[model samples]
Target: MKESEFIKKNSVFWRKLKKELKRSGPLTCRDTFPDDYEKVCYQIGLSRQRGYNLELIDSLDSLALRMRQELYRKPSLSLHNLLYQFLVETPRVIRGNFSYVLAALFLFTLPAIATYFILLKQPHLAFVLIDPANIEHIEDMYRDNAPHLGAPADVDSRVMMFGYYIKNNIGIDFSCFAGGILVGIGSIFFLVFNGFFLGTIFGHLENQGLGYNLSLFVVSHAPMELMALVFSGAAGMKMGFSFLIPGPYTRLHSLRKSSLIGVKFLILAAIMTFVAAAIEAYWSSLPHLDMQSRVIFSLSNVLLIGAYVGLLGWKRGPI
Candidate 1:
């Protein structure tokens, strides 16, 4: 076509393009223009070869406007996909027997509760259970050539009392947390055994007249330690449940997901255990602590446990 004749023929088209550009400030050509500035120049070169002065509008702002419009357009979201992912994927994560871990940890408390009965009958056991370093003086009633209770206070037994607490508490917490894979059976067994042992030991101490002193030492820190164990149990149950009822995903996939949750719980448990150990070592064992002080520490422990349980419920209705 002749240049003048083609220009005349496309005059109306050019007018419409100019009008759109004036209204939308260069975004109008978003459909036709290339997003990249260099690419837009390339297209303009082609348009000029076809006898159009598209170069007259070559600028960064024009190119950027076109690019933004092209990049911003997206398909609308609908309820179908949202519902499918929520209904199908979310349940597999939420529904399961996480309670078993808590139940198991609760069982561990039994030993602590029952120790009194043993301590009353077998006064010797109090000395046996009393940490060797904490025992005040040597006496004959202890069968292992060990010091009996009611002996003079040693006042200066230099050992890593705190270190022992940390090591034992951390180890037990990890064991309980990881053991949930037995579907809480292992954790529960461990908790019950520990609880009964601890209870009996304390009971023994109370029978021996050292109970108040020991209470001043333990009540401050045992709360965090016990709560940490319960959290660990929850972590383990999380893993076991994932294995038992892996809904849509293969067992392996479910295990991987559950394992992650387990790890998170285990890590939190470990941190709490460490905190408890620090408190037990430094704050709880102060010499000559009074009754009011002991009561305050004991009450604080209850609050901590209650707060942890509350946390479990706060996130979602208990797993």
Candidate 2:
């Protein structure tokens, strides 16, 4: 069939799909979505195969991409919905916005690595990024005879520590995310500052021969906790980038759209931080876990979290 005939035949279907795609309300089951999606996919391939006009091909391509974004973006609240969100939507969003996440990771880790090495060479300079008074406290916490970073305490004390962890880390996460309003400067500063701050502590402890205790204290929760930073930082950058490249939308509209996505990343960060707090309070604080055990536990965390974000929900469906 000719291109015009092909379009004329499917005009009603394309129009209906376009209307559904532009709906502002929650997407419900029309039971025709799968067929609509598959047909659109076929039309796209057919258009390209037949060397149709660029406009026809572009419209179909854009529609397909938006459909992919919305495929698992349901707003229902149920046990099944929650499971689906975690197993599918979360990873999909991560993969979709993964470049920002990588940028966040790079901005965070590069400074950390640089600071750790610099401080290791010149241990006295730790006071630049770390507080002078706090250095002694850290030494006391990780001293040879009394390593106390995550020292065992009563159940009540552990609960308090858990609360403290949540409060502090989430505060940082929020700052990293909210800083997007400042065109991402705030997020970058916080990530870089925190990196240097933590690196200073690590290098200073290592210099003082207290690295062993610190390793055991942080290993188990570090992966998830650090990923919270990545998520929030990336979210903020996403929001900030809206102003720089609003694309076809108005500035406010683009910001609103990007902020919605940013909030999803923040939610992921919050959940991970909660779990990190639990680990830090209960498991990481447990005394006498061997170095080998700590290493293994941390490795497992890395593998699990990495695989979940990198592997699951990987394929972009036609929807």
Clashes of 2: 1
- Best-performing candidate as measured by lDDT: 2
Work out the TM-score per prediction.
0.53, 0.73
- The residue-level lDDT of candidate 1 at 18 comes to 45
Q: Report the number of backbone clashes for model 1.
A: 20
The RMSD (Cα, Å) of candidate 1 is 13.9
lDDT of each: 0.60, 0.85
Candidate 2 versus the native: TM-score?
0.73
